[model samples]
Structures are given as structure tokens and as C-alpha cells.
Target: MKTETKIMASILIFIAILLAGAVFFLSGDQKTMSQGEGNQLTYKIDYSNGQKIGSDSAKIKLVEFSDFQCPACKGFEPFLKQALTDYKNDILFVYKHFPLPQHLNAKTAANMAEYAATEGKFWQMHDKLFETQEQWSALKDPTEFFIKLGKEIGLDETKSREAIEKSLYNNLISRHKDEGINLEVSATPTVFLNGVKLKLQKFSDLTQEIQKQL
Candidate 1:
């Protein structure tokens, strides 16, 4: 009788282990599905959509999803500018918007930059926003500040103001964010060399990566 009881206890333990594993696997699958909402994840580069500079036919594409209000992005600007200047013929640099929710002025600044793009002056506004990020980023309403920046970059004040008020570039900005999300970009200054996402610790890291592809 005692031997029979031991056998039954072992059988119950084995069954419990199997049930636990099944639960774990199902929960793991559910977590993954819930995170991405059961949709197919797409990760592809749109070569022409973002603000681009350098040789159109260049073999290396350096794409950066950045926010103007991010200090780290600002800190990385000089290095990127130097790189752009240094590799004008070899590298095609594309700038996409990825304004984090924590930064209040980032999206507005991105809109102004996009508006400037329509006037054939995106890079100019891009520089202006990063240059004055500290000042305008703190204002209660950065609309006037951004318009002022637009003016500094030769964007028409009335048109810039209207665009900001109307949020004309919202769709484009959202699309950029969506693309970043698909690529699992959770931080500003997420850069991709060609299609492979880069883990950038510094400008030297970027230099080495670019050299490898060149």
C-alpha cells in the first residue's frame, strides 16, 4: 500500500511539471503577441522620405532618428556635422524625426523643420533648432519660439506660425515615429548604417562602422 501511494505521488509531480511548462510557453507567446499586437513587424528603410544630404548614389547611408530637444542628440550634432562634411561623396546622411514624449518641444521643432523642408531649407532649420534647443525648449508655449527660429532660418514667419498652429506635419512625424517603433528604436539618435541598426557609444564607433562599409 505504501509503495502504491509513492507511485501516485510521483505521477502527480510529473503532471504538475508538465502543466507548469505549458503555462510558461503559452504566457511567453501571449507576451510577445500582446507587445506587437499580433501584427507583422516590418523593418525597412525609406531612402527618400527623410531629410537627406550627400551623394544620392552613395553606397553608405547613415540614417539618424533624432529629437531636437534631446541634449544627447545636440551633443552628437557636431560629430555628425563633421562626418557629413568629411564624407560628402561617400555617405548619404538622412535625418528622421523621433521626438520622445518626455520632451515637450521636440515634435513642434520637428514640424518646423519639416515645414522648412517644403521651402528647400530643412538643414538650415535643423541646425537652428539644435543650436537653440535649450532656449526654446523651456518655454511654456514654444510656438512663438519655434516661429522665431524659423525666421532665423529664413522661413516665412506667417507661414511657419500657421503650420505650427495647424500641426501640418503631424502625420509625417507620426510616420517617422512608427517607423522607429517598428525598428525597435526606444531612444533618440538611433542610427542605422545601411539597414543594420548601430550601437553607437561615440563618434569613433560611427567612424569605424562607416569605414568598414566603405
Candidate 2:
């Protein structure tokens, strides 16, 4: 009888320890998010262009801070493209970066895409990066992957490589990040329609909310 009680007590103790560890891990993640200066984001003011593809003076100005390696951002792309198609004359789209550290290749991918922006291939490279995210995101050397993507998009490989190597638009990327932080972006794939936060859950939610605003 005593042995049975000891066994049950041991099992309970193990479960308690497991639960405590899980709580600790989750808390650490929250702490990391709130760790920056002022414990909040501060976006620097800059009017520099960021790979503008559509009309600059559209009625709806949408700014998105996303990571190339983020799956949620990938899922949101089709919806965004469809929005452009549906509201062609009404929206001006802007892209920015908020790369999470867990996704190792996001920063380089963002920088490379910024370089591609110089050649008018930002959107193309942006789409391609999301399309091939699973391939290069985990690799130690993303050069070949980036090169292949540039070739696929018909960009000058030499220019693309040189741009990334030189950290072309590095300052612009930094400014975008700072801007996003200042705007209270705590995660990748944050979208603002006319400077108002888009409460995202599904496609219909985006269309309905945006349509109302329009």
C-alpha cells in the first residue's frame, strides 16, 4: 500500500515539474518580445522610397511589415495580390521588414530583396523568397539560393550579388524596422491600411474591413 502511494506521489511530482518548466519557457518568450529600448518600438522618420511597384498616390495606403520566411506572411500574399487586383486604383502598397531571429535567413533575404528593389524587381524577388522559403531558410549558405532566384526573375546576377554584399539599402531596411517598431508592430505580417491596423484573421475579414473603410 505504501509503495502504491509513493508511485502516485512521484508521478504527481513529475507532472508538476513539467508544468512549471512549460510556464517558465513561455514566460521567457514574452520577456524577449518586451526587451528592446523603452520596452517598445521607436520608428525613425524617413520619406525614402521602399520598392514602390504600384501607384504612389493611390487612395488607400497600405504598409506591411513582414518577414520573407514567415509562413503567415506567405499565406497573406495571395490575399494582398487579390486586393491589388480588386482595388487597383485605390491602394498604394509598401513593404517593410520585421524579421524574427528564429527564422535565420530572414534578414539576408530582406536585404537581398531590398537590393532587388533597386532594379525594379522587389515584388518579384519578394514573391520568390516566400515561394522558396523552405529551401534556403534553413541552409547555412543562402547565396546559391538567392542567385538562383535572381536568375529566375531575370535580374542581373552580378548586380544582385554586389548589392547584397554591399548591404545596399541596409539603412533603408533599418529605418523600416525602426518605423515598424515605433508603429507598435510586435510580430511579422503586420498590415496597416491607411495607417489603421488591419485586424487579420481570414480573407473575408480583410476585404470586408477594407471595403468598409473605402
Highest TM-score model number? 1
Instruction: Estimate, for each residue in 104-167, the C-alpha lDDT of model 1 and write its tens digit.
Output: 8888888888999999999899888888888988887899888887877678999998889898
Clashes of 2: 2
Checking candidate 2 for backbone clashes, the offending pairs are: 43-178, 43-182
Per-model TM-score, in order, reads 0.79, 0.74
What C-alpha RMSD separates each model from the true structure?
6.4, 10.8
List pairs with backbone clashes in candidate 1. none
- Worst 10-residue lDDT window for candidate 1 reads 31-40
**Model 2, position 201: C-alpha lDDT score:** 73
Model 2 per-residue lDDT tens digits across residues 148-208: 8999988888887876677676687777777777667888788876656666778557767
The lDDT of each candidate is 0.84, 0.76
